[model samples]
Target: MKEADRCCGSAGSFSIIHHDLSMKVLERKISNIVTAKAEVVATSCPTCTMQLSYGLKSHGLTGQVMHPVQLLAKSY
Candidate 1:
């Protein structure tokens, strides 16, 4: 969560249209997740959830990504 405010580079179709650049940006986000030792990453953006999930798998990390609402629902 080091750069929680930073963009995951998904930006809707950005990741698919600019795969290389998107991956580069996603790498930074993934690094922060690793540094934070996150087991799950929660975000409200659907694109971010998909991007983060892909990033985690590509990095060989076993973390899960979910929407913030999903996390809140799980707490009930």
Candidate 2:
């Protein structure tokens, strides 16, 4: 897994209060995803997942960002 797959900038309410820093962190996370060559990025927290998905979209990455459970349910 890449560093991006293991990171999130939406540290709860901190994301909303610290928009600039959060965005900067999100950017780094997206880069990590590309470096990792991940097809899907799953996260447990909805806020963090949103950051992941939005970051991917903004960065023009086609990788999927979803909750682990959502991915598992889709598989079955």
CA-lDDT, candidates in order? 0.92, 0.84
lDDT tens string, model 1, 1-76?
Answer: 7988999989999888998999999999999999999999999888998899999999899999988888899989
- Model 2 per-residue lDDT at 25: 87
Error of 2 at 18 (Å): 0.9
Model 1 residue 39 distance off true place after TM-score fit, in angstroms: 0.8
Clashes in model 1: which pairs?
none
Top TM-score hit: 1
Residue-level lDDT tens digits of model 2 in 19-61 = 9999988888887788889889888888987888889888888
lDDT at 31, model 2: 77
Number of the top-ranking candidate, with lDDT as the measure: 1
Q: What CA root-mean-square deviation does each model show from the true structure?
A: 1.0, 1.7
